[model samples]
Target: MSILKDKNILLGITAGIAAYKSAHVVRLFIKAGANVKVVMTPASKDFITPLTLSTLSKNPVYSSFTDEEDDNEVWNNHVDLGLWADVFVIAPATANTMAKMANGVCDNILLATYLSAKCPVYFAPAMDLDMYKHQSTKASFKKLTAYGNKLIPAGTGELASGLVGEGRMAEPEAIVKFIENDILVQLPLYGKRVLITAGPTYEALDPVRFIGNHSSGKMGFEIAKAASNLGAEVVLVTGPTHQKIENHLVAVKPVVSAEEMYKEVHKHFKSSHIAILSAAVADYRPKNVADQKIKKKDTTFTIELEKTKDILKSLGEIKTNQFLVGFALETNNELEHAKGKLKAKNLDLIVLNSLRDKGAGFGVSTNKVTFITANNTIIENELKSKANVAKDLMELILKQTHA
Candidate 1:
């Protein structure tokens, strides 16, 4: 998925020949799963109609401070519009608008909204080569950039005056890509790789039956999503579960047994900066497996079991410059056992979940956890949904790793 997914984009249009391209910009943003709202200078309507932009964006286009409906004037709040946006992009920003923006001009609703916006603002200049090269225009660029507004450099192309030079607004596709890259580079986890394990490992006894737990893989899946959103490339090794995810940054590896999960995790652990093992892997498996379903020929049945490889401990032993985390779900002596495991397994941190606490443990959407660091520091957290828990865990990891 595009990093722009679910972002609120406020598109500002101005009076310039390139204003016609703003329609395509809105379409591209919407296609990338962003919510778009258009704010246009009144004169820009001459190039592109508000009706067309409104139709594409599925939201009312704002051009003036007031709208006349049934002879009633409904005021459009510029401050509200500015506050609602996660990002603001002014495309085809005319020389007139650029000068005004640099000088604190707020005559138009678009300008007013820009002045009031607290989010990052990006402006794409559009003008003839001569006007773009003018000393005043150069000063505007310097002033706006010095004020922290990003500039999408104008492309070199044929201008409205039939002269070919660098004054044309960037193409819609280029504009969207530029913004996505800018947002990603600023994220804390950008360029990091995370390895995560999730779900219940199934140990099969026969073709018809196997052993597994009630783990829904909800918590681990949530962590994968959280990590991906923070700009990490994730390798999620998951066992049997109905949980699903749709992030481009996450690669899902399906495993059926504890053995399979162990191998998959190790494959990616060496290159990972962080590894979080949350899978409820079976401690034992049937020593001998039947080729086919075992019919109940007798009233009773017994099968010998053997210890499965401990994935977390193995990773901890070989870890080098990698932050390793583990999960401990205990019914008794929760803190003592969790702390023991944190040190015994060589984990940097361990998340402790007590079945004694209501709304916690397997098959539930909520979790109450206590974090135990390797240094014996303990931090308790309130009951929260799995998604929020995932976010909290990531925040803790960020602080510890200084990523």
Candidate 2:
């Protein structure tokens, strides 16, 4: 799904032959599930009718501060429009408009809104090849970028003039893709790779039977989504569960046993800057497996069990620059035991969850956790949905790793 879904996109159009293309841009934004509002420079209406943009955007097009039909009876609030948008985009931005934006000249509502906007700003320049190559235009580009504005570089194609060069505003589809990718790459975790383990590993007793826990993989799935949304590429090593992820940033690796999970984690750990182990791996498995499913016969039957290898401890032992994080689900002495495990496993951080707390642990959607840092710093979080908890955890990780 597009990150633009449910996003408020404020689009500004300036006077240029490329203004006609802004109609298609509005349509594209609407098709991508964005609520779009069009703001046009007064001269832009000559190239493309306000009705055309308004109809496509499904919102009234604003040109001046007040309606020209009335004697300035109604006021248009550029500040409100600026604050209401999740992203501000100026497509087909003429060199004149770009100059005004770069110099803080707010002669129009669009310029005023750009000056007041707190959200990310993106501008697509459209002009003749010579105008684009001019030193003044290049200076404007540098200034805008330095002010934290993203530039959607013009394409190379035929211009309104007989000449063809790199001065065409990007196509609507390219603009959308560029905006989506830019938004992600600008996030704090944009360049970091994260490895996460989720769900409960199943120890097979036979082909038809296995030993597993009540873990639903919800927590780990939430963490993966959170990290992906924050622009990190995630490698999710998961045990058997129904949880699914739609983010393209996350790559899922399915495993059914602790041993399988261990191998997958180690495979991706070297490249991962952060490793979060949230899987509920079985502590023990049958020492010997039966060739076939044993039929129930005796009233009291028992199978010999053997301890499974500690995947978290193993990672901790070999840890270098990777930030190792583990989860401890304890019943009693939760903090003490979690701290011990944090130290024993050489973990940089440990999340402690108590089964004694209602709405926490196992298959539930909510969790209450305490974060214990390697430096003995503790942070307690109140009960929250697993998704919210994942966000909090992600924030902590971002603060620690500075990625």
Candidate 3:
């Protein structure tokens, strides 16, 4: 049995000189037992054909997120594609593609998949040394890290431009091994690890419904995926959703309610080098949960509510030197509250989400966020896709790791 058994992996090909090597990367993903689907940027076709990738992946390739091809019974749905995968890997991600991935330019289907993906993604850079070493490219890399995406460092090799230093994509074997070593659940956590709690935790009132927010677990899963890509063993503790992490690169422990989330995260937080409490945890749960569906008594029924366990605070108490990151989604006074949580929870940094802004926050393909560190350093960003948002988060984590 393979570690990637029965998993959905989206292979995103960007415009790059080394697009040719991505074929080998696809081959490796397939050999590892993943059901590979390919998304190609328009420029990538200049280097490789859809037919070639289709033959390799055994699935029809999709080029645009919104393209409805002739005679196609089922229209291309980016949400369906996003929900379809266990992981999204962008091999030979060019400087242009990487920049777009960071900046939220949905020029193609590959970028849309990155924007909407609710799972782990691996962004592998492939470009000429000069272009790769440029400041813009450097910024793009930083942006990706800030979003909590794994960056597979490019290697040195002969370049398509006849000049090279360190811009080749890592070998297929090495990339595959990166997935195995970083993502797969290993006993390494028994010694050292990073724990992440993700998705949306519901506070139920009755059997049929509950008080919950739309987390979708997109960013949180991106963090786990990024950490796994970087060789840090990860544990993803997630809540209820249609999402499934089977056969993932890392150990995934699923739970539903706030109580279950507390139990699971508390059990493993101690061993983590870092813990990102990214789940949209319910702040108030029903004071009394009904075992059966509550019947409507009148036009309006009132119910008492209680505060949820302060997961971050509890973790902060016994957290020791381990790192902790928090997320704050606000309707108003976004920066103020996010900064407050950074200090109150003993977090190194806290991500800010403003529901007031368009194309950002909760149940959408795009996000506009601000990053606040414990030092009160504020970095403001514009509206971009979530995949790029993921990259930006990864950079912050890397900075923290280095610091």
Q: What 10-residue stretch in candidate 2 is worst by lDDT?
A: 1-10
Each model's backbone clash number: 0, 0, 21
The better-scoring model by TM-score among 1 and 2 is: 1
Q: Write the per-residue lDDT of candidate 2 for residues 339-389, one digit (tens) a residue.
A: 999999999999999999999998889999999999989999999999999
Q: Clashing residue pairs, candidate 1?
A: none
Kindly indicate the candidate among 1 and 2 with the higher lDDT. Answer: 1
Instruction: State residue 354's C-alpha deviation in candidate 1, in Å.
Output: 2.3
Query: Could you give the candidate ranking by lDDT, starting with the highest?
Result: 1, 2, 3
Candidate 3: where is the Cα deviation over 4 Å? 1-29, 32-192, 246-248
RMSD values for the candidates in order, in angstroms, are 1.9, 3.1, 14.8
The local distance difference test score of model 3 is 0.81
TM-score of each: 0.94, 0.87, 0.56
Q: What is the lDDT of candidate 2?
A: 0.93
What lDDT does the true structure give each of the candidates? 0.95, 0.93, 0.81
